[model samples]
Target: MYKKLLLLLLFFKCFAGFAETIRTDVLVVGGGASGVAAAIQSARSKIKTILIEPGPWLGGSMTSGGMCILEGNRTLASGIYAEFKNHIRELYKPRLGYDTTTNAPLVFEPYTGAAILKRITDTVKNLTVKMNTPFTAVKKDGTGWEITIMQSGKAVTIKAKLVVDATELGDVAAAAGVLLTAGFDSRTDTKEELAPQNATNQIQDISYLAILKDYGRGIDRTIPQPAGYDATQYACLNNADIKKMLASAKLPNDKYLINWSDCANQYPITSDDLNPENREATFKKAKLRTLGLIYYLQTRLGFKNLGLTDDFKTTDHLPYLPLIRENRRAAGMVRMVLDDIYTPYTRGSQLYRTSIAVGDALPGQHYSIPGAPHINYPPFPAYSIPLGAVVVKEQENLLVTEKAMSVTHLVNSSISYPSVQMTLGQGVGATAAYCIFFETTTKNLKPRIIQGEILDFKGMLMPFADIKTTDRDYRAIQQIGATGLLQGIQKPNGNSARVLFMPDSVVHTAEIKPFLNEIYSRAFLWFNKEKPGELFTIGNLLSYISEMTLRDPKNLQDGIQKTWKTYYKFTTGFDATRPVTRREFAVLANRFFNPFARKVDMSGKFIN
Candidate 1:
């Protein structure tokens, strides 16, 4: 009996040793929307990637949180976000009458969104996904990361070359010893005019979102009155019309996402609430607030038929995760501020050239927090996200995305949208791939090389509303726009705004000459010698290109004219004397001189 017991113990110990360590090129913690996108992009880039999620479903906000109504980037669809939007459209358009042609906001059921994401992730070759796995600990192992995760009630170790902190609340980054800033910023610290006099540990309001489905007109689907429910808590909803409120976030089918802030459902959070030990109790309070709002709608407003939907597969009908608007932000190489967005072109640091993602949402705060300062600012314009914002300065081989990116609290108001988060994820994924392929650290990697990889994957480096992904000159326009050679014009469109490239407009020498001189040394000599007119003609452009490349002027012009109609598909006949439009100039100059090839550092200064 003693011999048998010793042999059994030895067998169990050997099995534990064998199943202990798993290796991968990249390990992405938290399978949120950004985490999923990062894993997908890294896997598609031909790297062995593993994504781990605490919950069973992917898509933190849009799926588990039940906030399926996508905001911002309606026209700027690029990369995995575009692919996800297409999949949502294809599945729901015919059956649920979803409009696919127009640029309307896309909405869907939360479960369908998660299933679609699962299907998309399954198609990628070098990716491995583990659900019901929670991150436990992380430590540096030489140049890589040695992570411990809880799976099937046992601790499993993972060794990864790089780590991406895509957690909903920047948990991984915090664990990795990255400096984090939470809550409001002071005007003195961020140098923003709109910030308050002092900083606080108060973050944006979070909502425990509930999706309501109409069972039928006669059915009474109202939930039982929740504990600690108080009617006066939702006094703000007294004047709100029930129909109008329900219509605010109506999704596909007869469902509505109950993320209303007016009903006092938006719960305020502080640094204390972010503690893992206290998070559950904190979330419970938020859930109770949402239930109070729901009770107000059902008992008082006479909407008993609209009840919580079983979208998240939770025992309680509420969403599995809360819709977190803000969280702990990592301190990266560059901290993006409001000035970066307000005046991207004229900003002292040309961070626009290092753009990896784009966002056009206006900056505004939820009015749920009492004593929250109200600062009125100008309409927000589309802005580029610098690569440095996602790359951690203190930590090596680490990247943070989603709401945890390195941005000022003021700037986070605009970039926390789901679309921007996904694009940011794709950008960091490409960044990780580049570092792995070249065997370099994050500090040594070039921003333009990552931008090039994103462009090759049909990602938008700059948000140009008029330039669609299907356009033949999309790459040219995006690349040129990144170099600041052709800046976009911001136009107010109803309540929102967009940055138009105005490709059809005629190019003026004065508009581009300043940027040309900044980029090319010979451009100054060409402008001095030619003394070109206000209207830059095709002949003038060709002469400038000749000066830069030292090519034969006549030969360059002849080559451009030949391909002008055949390859470029320009409807207008090639003319040497006529003024060239922005589209014509962008295409020709991009093809011949290739100014976009010039490298820029993280500060947007030309390095070579």
Candidate 2:
């Protein structure tokens, strides 16, 4: 008997050396919306937490995903949601260049966004955040979960008491065999009016959101029609689905609920949504076509195709990655419904005591999925959120994030807005952190207690500004205000105005100087450049930028050269100091985003 027991022990011990175990109190996956918040909260709780993001940049939708607007969290939506906005204010305020309007500090650049996230996250303890580490697979391991992570071309195993799947597509939960519902569940799985009866695990449609850069003048700023660009030769651009909006020109804008006239240089430019199953055929085709759409429009009409402008006149083309507007949502314990926003709750009772975060996103009408209902926003009084929605019903170990979470289809349509989701993301982030600190599941937390924790973590739950005019830096203008980048308030007289922020207004080198200095962008190089005071030409800027910064200067240089040689070679250029419009730089800006690149900066600081 003794010999047999000793042999068994030896057998168990034999595998120890090769285990390569990474033990953490909390393992938060996907560092976009929810994961970032969750990881930050976990670390702030002073518990050991590891954040694994498949992408290079941390700000999933806002930065790398390039969806800059804040979503969800309203006045009634407090907790972790409030804290994220506050961080934006505290960190990005001073760096916002002088605002032409309220002059509130705003950070328009994407790379700057990454830097901000890095700064806030680096301050936490027992937290290891690694990019390009996608969670490949997951499995149940008794009380905890065993997570497999792929990083730098190798697979590593991790053991976490709590695992948060803040992945963009509810990856881990699905991999772990969690029961989930995808696409718009009309009456089939859910009694949602906007859903279809055949909603059989069909996922909601995902679209790629891209930013174009048009520097006012230059042939390079223009888009040469796609290889087959022809007014007569129409395919995807002329598809009845998209053409339906094209005929109305205002349809896409209306569905998005934005006055496009105010978007400045903003126009359509995208590749394929990264999560698309047909990445090579479909996604790649979409990206080229997005630019081609602008090219067609420009060639048809005598105009240019400008890229999305974060700050500075430089071309910021395709989004570092595709924006997954909607994805697989988990089946949670107590799903949130649209009616729940104005809950049919007993007066003194709360709908959910596990309130992890808050939001106020009213769904827009973008019908990628068939039979999607058109939703109009009539202000529902801002409300609170519970932790039940964060827990994957079948798999208690995972938490859904980004565009994926548990919500009644109708309810999701409302909260699915970009601004509101950010708030919700923060809430779950705090929940993950709390669970790590207390060593418990989010299911066990009380909403009031969670609220307290969120407050303690310094996240605020404030209502929408009576005067809302957040700039490129978002609420960041208030945080970095000391640098004098911002002038006065978010809007003139500190009141909300009918202002459509022009994307191009933020891109001046003069404005960037303050941002670069405040964010610690190679101070030595800032002063010691061979091409000091050169015009804001892509060629000129690339010439002196630190090699460390331009990990592959030649590649970026070649793109710019090709673009310039092809387009901008003849157009007049803008003065780096002068304020310009997106329409002016339309051509050059349109191609800034790469087809497959995540962000322009190799350092992972989000590029504008």
Candidate 3:
């Protein structure tokens, strides 16, 4: 009887140790800001999605990296990023005295930020999050991918129809034989004036950020001197004022984010440090530098109360991951460059039509490393990110987000911010869902269908500064802007610039005639009957719509006039003789002609 009981126990233990294979419609192989957004959006689209993270927490740089202070894109909130911002505001506003103003930078504790992300992710249906799970290997199987991940000391295989490579170093993409480029690009290679003359293996400096908290004036929370501590190494901070420096990144709960560069805490990394074998040791060195900085602040600066916070809940009290600014960039269908942001309207490729994400942040780069090339680019206006930028060139069923997407080294500075990355992740999720629903490959996907999905989810297709999400006609304006039927005016605002779509401005025949003629064949015949350089009146717009949609002008006019004041809420009465505003034309044209419904190729060219 004893031997039989022991055999039963042994059999149960053996059965529990067997590895399991899970099937999912989408698999996101990172729990960073972008990965979380991608998984949430993918699941929100009613697809079964799985998100795996090596770390214990979500929001990679925003929380685990101790970069809780968000910068740029103060007004361009959309999709998951907007949801994240709202969650932070709601969680901290009443209790923590957090700033809820529009233009104020978002500041919060690292742990609180991570919690907020987890809360938002928990409410999403069809999404499964696996923490402490590290990606092991990836292989292309049929039209989908078969990925191996380590969970609970066992290998778990996930067969996914679509895969999003949101890893910090693009490890999943690299393992799947995707073409990736690292380091800087030469001016001749990228054709950018601001790029270096020659390419180099050197990348941007990595910051192992530390979060310090004020534990009152009388307490002594100063830590012991870290190993290899040198006073001269931190001589740069000697002359700086302590009060001003600490206020630079002050958080809601008396916490401060120490990601400054004046003290030289930013550590330089080489291509070799990016290797998995060397990465751990490289991170140890960076952490030591941060610890040394913290010690310098406490002992030397006489701030004994400001000590390392237990926000991360780690033994060392340091952030879980260092703030990596650049990483392996995938070579996608189109490589975005500086010229794309500077001149999107008249560019060689009309990528605006294929836009899936919008970013308005100013471009910046950190060159703290020795002998690193520094080239300052002129201020650029808000621009749209193309769908092809995230679609890998070699892989048909794979997509990449965050810093791994296809953009030149120079263009990465603008698109790599947390908000922009989150929006891009949302776009990637919608694109993957569209492909799955249509049962088509990434190469065969149309831009308009994906753009429609983004709009359906209230995601911005164009970065129009003046347009707000609350505006009733926001979707129509964004759709028309994406089609290049209307272009936003780029105006300089202080150091940065913004693209404004002045909807109240009256439309001119010449300004829109060219685009109209290019998009619609009947537009040419209609323009032949109208005079050049004339104001595009409501009567003329109705005539044009009638010619394009082959509808009776009287019926179209009667329907618009009845709904103008009540349903459409147009303040101005429908007068055929009066000149039409951009807003009115966009709404009416969007309803009748539906120019945005036209199919566009990857290059944003209209398909015949």
TM-score, every prediction: 0.97, 0.61, 0.95
Clashes of each: 0, 81, 0
Model 3 residue 535 CA deviation (Å) reads: 2.6
Error of 1 at 552 (Å): 1.5
Most accurate candidate by TM-score: 1
Taking the tens digit of each residue's C-alpha lDDT, what string does model 2 give over 438-491? Answer: 667645654444545555554433232331322222222211221122222222
- Candidate 3 residue lDDT tens string, 219-280: 99989888889878788888897799888888877888898884558888876687788999
Write model 1 residue lDDT over 138-230, tens digit each, in one string.
999877898899989999999999999888888888888888888889999999998998998888888999989988899888788988999
Count backbone clashes in candidate 3. Answer: 0
Model 2 lDDT at residue 360 = 45
State the weakest 10-residue window (summed lDDT) of model 3.
12-21
Compared with the true structure, all predictions reach lDDT values of 0.87, 0.52, 0.86
Can you give the lDDT of residue 476 in candidate 1? 91
User: Cα miss at 220, model 3 (Å)?
Assistant: 1.6
**What's the ranking of the predictions by lDDT, best on top?**
1, 3, 2
Candidate 3 residue pairs that clash: none
Candidate 1 runs further than 4 Å off: 1-15
The alpha-carbon deviation from the true structure for residue 258 of candidate 2, after best TM-score superposition, in angstroms, is 12
